[model samples]
Target: MNTTTLTGLELRPLAVPADVSELETPAGHDFATMMDVRNRVYFEISGHHDESMSAAELLPHYQPNPDEIRFMWVAILDGEFVGRAGIDIPLEEGSKTAFWQIELLRKSWGKGVGSAAYELLENKAREHGRTVLQSWASHPAADGVEQIEPPTGFGSIPDDHAAHFYKRHGYSLEQVERNSAFDLRGSFEIVERLLAEATAAAEGYRVVQWEPPTAEEYVAGYAWMKSRMSTDAPSADLEFDEEVWDAERIARHDALWTDAHQFVLVTAAQHIATGELCAFNELVVGKDRAEASHQEDTLVLKEHRGHKLGMLVKCAGLVKWRELVPHSPRVLTYNAEENRPMLDINEAIGFTPIAYGGAWKKVLE
Candidate 1:
């Protein structure tokens, strides 16, 4: 792709080997400067840390090969990183399309830097074999209802401008899931109560915990959980290929745990009613800081919903966490503002709301 200027900006992918040294500078060196652009454009605009931007977390989703998962585009003005976008090709089941996630520095908005980045990405997608593109576009708080619009050629929107931007592009709404998250440090008590209530509601069904009989024993359970999850959870448009995530992937997670952290779950005979407490947590260790785990991917089966299994298994996990990791600080989570059921349980626990927003996806067709 040739370099092009849009509204006085240059947009391109960070060339590795050449840019690695530049991008890897210490956080103190240029961390906040680079992070501020991303946090404001992506996080702050979406009701996340609306005031002060936190340090950059792990590179959104890191894969061994950049070509396999994400294509990052950045816009520079006077040599300063001002805007950026990411094309996440999540190799998960049922997600059939490539989507775009766009972010803009506060000062960079209103200029065409975002548009330039989009055009470059769109062209790159066409070069690679991406036919249909999809994005989860958010409406401004003023717009109210969540809408997914069709992708035009180039141009993306921040969460707030998702509805208007996509509508302008020509995409149609395929799905909308109200995502939710919760902090789990001591929040397990509430999850336990919810589990009890759900179990009580599920009269004939029994919830049991199963530890892998052997390291290999998890294949069946993992497959069962994956298939059952495919049936129950919200459709994130992930395309299920040859089980890209398996025991090996799970074991990698197991490695991240201290003796205190273990994967636990509550399940019916063949179905996982609720329990992904350990799976969703994204644990990362920084240079100077201790490891932090983000509790995510909490889900209960559809038929198991009314029984309050959601709360129960979560609580069960929390109790286990407390017993095991007594020295940890707060566990963290983030949910789309609309997911109320989990929100209900989270509030019941002591997980005070921290950040709220939507994840945007744009497809190139």
Candidate 2:
């Protein structure tokens, strides 16, 4: 699809082929520029300087995945790239939703570029048989707004921000999330104390740690715990499906991480009597920029609740991650506004709220 704004700018999908070889040709240059624009827009909006993803880090996301169909496009005005947009459509029959994103340089705002880009994305989503379209936008907390109360499906930000942008486009707020950060360079005494306490509380459960390419013996169990994350985690009002996982899927994910030069530290709680993996958490550090890491998935199986295993696995994983990447300055994580348990653990470990964002959804009629 092609869209022309009133200012004579055009929006269209990138001409790069779906093959990996494009990364080495002239298309590679455009891809890099596109990533730069995305990074700039993200930082400008989120006010988080250290969290931007580098080109190497974003490569895996652009690479084709068997279970997901991705589309990337750019908006050009006067022969200059001004905006980028994309959608990720799950190939599963049960999932009729698409996750979409649109990022434009600051200069392009107030123009019709974003609207045109979003319209194209909506058309693509409908063309793919998607019934629901979801997008997320980050907003920095106002000055002196230290402790933000959980959102109530509404925001107080000005109408020009992302929250209002989605609202104006007919999307309803489904859930709110807080982006928090834990300074890894700070004293480890708190983490150690939490670990000791959790270890004592979660009796009969031993902690196991591993890096990429999970051991042959634990692959199936690891995949099982990973699968539970989707169903067990608090998703608020969003429609989601229980992710299907297996040993092969785990291997494929690990390969992607390896190719992205990400160092993954996974720690899980193994029940002693049953020999079952009951809980697990993952911490991934990007090799390209070691100053920051991301807290991925942390899940405790339904049958194992109230064992303090969540704290146990998270603490163990953080410790191992710091050991592997001592120079990493901080770790970032996101949790639903209603997820008190995870938030409690995060706060107790010195993670402070950095920003707030919400999941916006629109049901296409």
Candidate 3:
């Protein structure tokens, strides 16, 4: 079937030979343009982390059997690839949800290309059995290298152009999300003071780390910690899609950590109660790149509260991380923006305001 036409754009089952070669051939140039457009639009709309795109950094997504990607939809206008959109479904089995990320080269906008591409992609999603169509849309902005505050959890959108786009189809809000980050290498004096304060408060708690725990033990520990996390987090009122963090789920997470940095803090008994802290961090480093670590989930159980266990755990992890990866310049984290208490804790540890990563959601029926 003809997947290309002069009438505007066409949608076809993303095939290997055609799609891969097209992307791989001019991958560098294509990625640079893609990155430029992404940064431009995001910077103009909502000030946030804007960086020049490099093809080498994007090559991995097109590499052999990368698991993070689900499908790709390309926009062809006047016989040139003008934009791309895709769904990134984490490979964990039984995950009922998936995420949407869309980018249009600046020149491609205002031509109805976005509408056409999304309709095709949405239909493709249904074919793939997608129950939810989630898209992360941001306000329009000019591209820059500096960081800006991301809009509310779901992104800035009184404009709601994107929301209307989804609504005109069939998407609705699921839940909102927010983000935050810290400067780890700012000043030793400040770091030392934060450490001292946290240490003073953590009288009896001792930090610990280990390889994969026994399946039964891992499941139990995660279950306990997850329950506490749910209630302690800002979303305590929202209905969680998943009930238990079981062994199989934990294992699936472990499988992704081929080069991940993980740490957990526990009491002398190794039991996870309030006052105990746990976190997982993903490391990103390069000589020419800004060194940053993404702090995934930091949890302090209910029983472990009030003693400043959260601060202690985070401090311990930071100190150890510095000792281990001294070159890492900063740490990034995301929490519901209204999560003030935790935000205060993060600020105490030197996490500065970076960008507003709004969490916009649209339900699928």
TM-score for each predicted model, relative to the true structure: 0.64, 0.92, 0.65
Off by over 4 Å in 1: 15-36, 40-43, 46-60, 65-67, 90-96, 137-160, 173-192, 199-220, 223-231, 236-244, 252-293, 301-308, 322-365
Q: Which candidate is the best by lDDT?
A: 2
Ranking by lDDT: 2, 3, 1
lDDT of 1 at 97: 52
User: Which portions of model 2 show Cα errors greater than 4 Å?
Assistant: 5-7, 15-24, 143-160
Task: Give the alpha carbon lDDT tens digit for every residue of 1-365 in model 2.
Answer: 77754567877676643444566678677777777787788878876656677666667767767778999898887788887999999876588889999888889887778788888999999999898898877766665543322245433333346665787789877777888899998898999999999999999999999988889878988989887876888866666656788888888888878877778888999999988999998888777546588889888998999999999999988888788888888999988877889899999988998877777789989
What Cα-based lDDT does every candidate model obtain? 0.49, 0.81, 0.53
Estimate candidate 3's alpha-carbon lDDT, on a 0 to 1 scale: 0.53
Report the C-alpha lDDT of model 1 over 80-195, residue by residue, as the tens digit: 78866667664654545566766776676666666677667677667656755655433334444443322222122233454545445554544443323344444454566665
RMSD of 2: 2.7
- Give the lDDT of residue 148 in candidate 1: 35
Cα lDDT for residue 22, model 2? Answer: 62
What is candidate 3's lDDT per residue for 43-67, written digit by digit as tens?
A: 5554544232333444344433433
